[model samples]
Target: MPTTTGMKGGGYYDANSREQRSASQIFLPWLEAAIADLPEPPPHQQSWNLLDIGSSEGANAIYTTERLITALRENSDLPIWALFDDLPTNDFNQMFLNLFPTGKSVIPANDVYTAAIGGSAFGRLVPPASLHVATTFNAIGFFETRPIAVLPGFILPMRPNPQAPREGVQVSEDELIPFQKQAHQDLCHFYRARAAELAPGGKLLVQIFGRNETHSTGHGICDVLSDALLDFVEADMLPRFFYENFIFPASYRNTAELIAPIESERELASAFRIEQVEARDVPVPFNDAFTANEDRAAWAKSYTGFLRAFTEPVLAAALPDGLPQENTIEKIYHRIDRLLQDYPDRYEFHFISIATLLTRL
Candidate 1:
């Protein structure tokens, strides 16, 4: 297995992450509700600390936090420290560029100090009970570590795409059960860490790509990527071993899986009260535009760019070091683009996310 590097860096992720940004709009109302009942800061604290974990490249996360901080400012005139956290390998420079463009703060008024912290999202990064409000949007679906060695048949463990058929590449429940368990364990770790960091009566909002009864975020996208790689293997351009060893280390959990730890674990149950838990589908901007204009070429490029922005870094890492890595990766993406253009409706993407708002007890 390849080492876990973060998303594509140096402004690439920020440029192509429209789907993620659009999906996060659902959190605005939930965030307002959380802020409406936010508790006062501790006596010793000088500044209100708001933490954003899994903050990728910064366009989406910054937009969300700006609104959150602005809303918080309306209630009180306390100094706010907005902190962004992500993996060490993430594009922090690019994120800082986005946050502090023109060398000005994200929120110019009201003592708002913006900073970045580099680390894993699964562990505690701040002092105990220091955070007043915390959020993670369109992140946390990724496991901190790869749970299983090799996903034998499919690129992702989610239910196979009914639209893109793979005759021999079906994942059974037996294979899927362990993956689900790992996802549950990861969610537990995340909540445990957040529970420790949040102050008494603090609000924590976690929203990530997830599955519902009707749709999953990974269904069509992963299937298409899997098919594109298989085409290269059949043409003798790539080795068979590459396909077997490559597995995306992320899982989309259902609402039951999202809330199971809070209900089952004694520690979590004692520490927090669930304010809301729900899963819903959000509109895909590129897909909607495609529907409106009926422009196949434009749709293919936009959709493929979004897919490559998130998946390409990991895909590049999975390749053998000796082979022309850049060219091979480009070929794969190009193949995907051609495939999407040829059969525009074959692989359609639907965005569904599970969200939970919790209050520390």
Candidate 2:
């Protein structure tokens, strides 16, 4: 349960998790397979335990948990006890309110039990071998704490290549290495924790934003925000160092990075068996909608809203301390929107989503 976007107000993710929907669509088939391939539980098993890590306000969980229950019924009619874990700051009230029309656990016919757990996903949330199936979305890669002070300059995670940048120098070698190591450590923690929580042969299905290649991560919207912040510096509205010192939280893993920890370490190597690892090219939400509705203005608005939901918390954390958060957040999005309107296609989101299916051993 990593800290979700937007620290203060709740519901940013619930309202604007467009990317999650798109990513989940791409992962639907795999999700089906993961559930279908689950090892049949022992005879007379009366109850099943399911965990939804980083379950933000319940829209995704309500649907995903239902899907899981439906699949589970195929094997046995045992009622499921679903645990939705997230940070304490999350809107659990909205979550349960949305699920139970009568504010009760029994969902008419489904009969699946549900509850909420609040904490960091980096640490263990449940007792060992307690969960039968675990699912997480867009929640991996975030460390409970900022590992170190932000790199000398740059508010977001910027890994400049060894080569030259046409406008300026890339993030130096010292800055690049630490950034990557921190991400790896965070990911290891995530895998190790899940390994312990899941029952032997339990299923784990997840969709994490990642890079396909080693050179760069899938920074579809992040780089755009970085450039937009730099534009503010150029426009003299915001200072240069604010742009320079902005360090974004979370990691974006590549395929190689994803496998390295599992294959290299003996204990972790034996923790789980990977069934599928897919690197999908996620078209920005508006780009796909634009082809259908064909409204540039509408597309621009959707794109801005998507970025605002997903990145606003990071933006808030990056801003200079004591700045007017509400107003400044608006200005940042407004500037980004203006840039998009000025040149409609100048920037298209470059996103690569990684979906993995593993069975805990």
Candidate-wise lDDT, in order: 0.85, 0.70
Model 2 pairs in collision: 1-121, 154-244, 154-245, 154-246, 155-245, 155-246, 155-247, 156-246, 220-350
Error of 1 at 251 (Å): 0.3
Tens-digit lDDT track of model 1 for 64-108: 888888788788888999999998888899998998788887666
Kindly list the per-residue Cα lDDT of model 2 for residues 1-361, writing each as its tens digit.
2434423235666776666767666776676666766666665666788898877777766777777777777776777788998888777887877677585654444657778998777789998878889888777755556665556444445564232122542456667677678777776887899999988889888777777654333343555566677767777667777876666676777777776777776887899888888888776667888889888788778778877775777677667755434477788888778766665654555557787788898
| lDDT of model 1, residue 43 | 69
Model 1: how far residue 127 lies from native, Å: 0.6
Worst 10 residues of 1 by lDDT: 1-10
Q: If scored against the real structure, what TM-score would every candidate get?
A: 0.97, 0.88
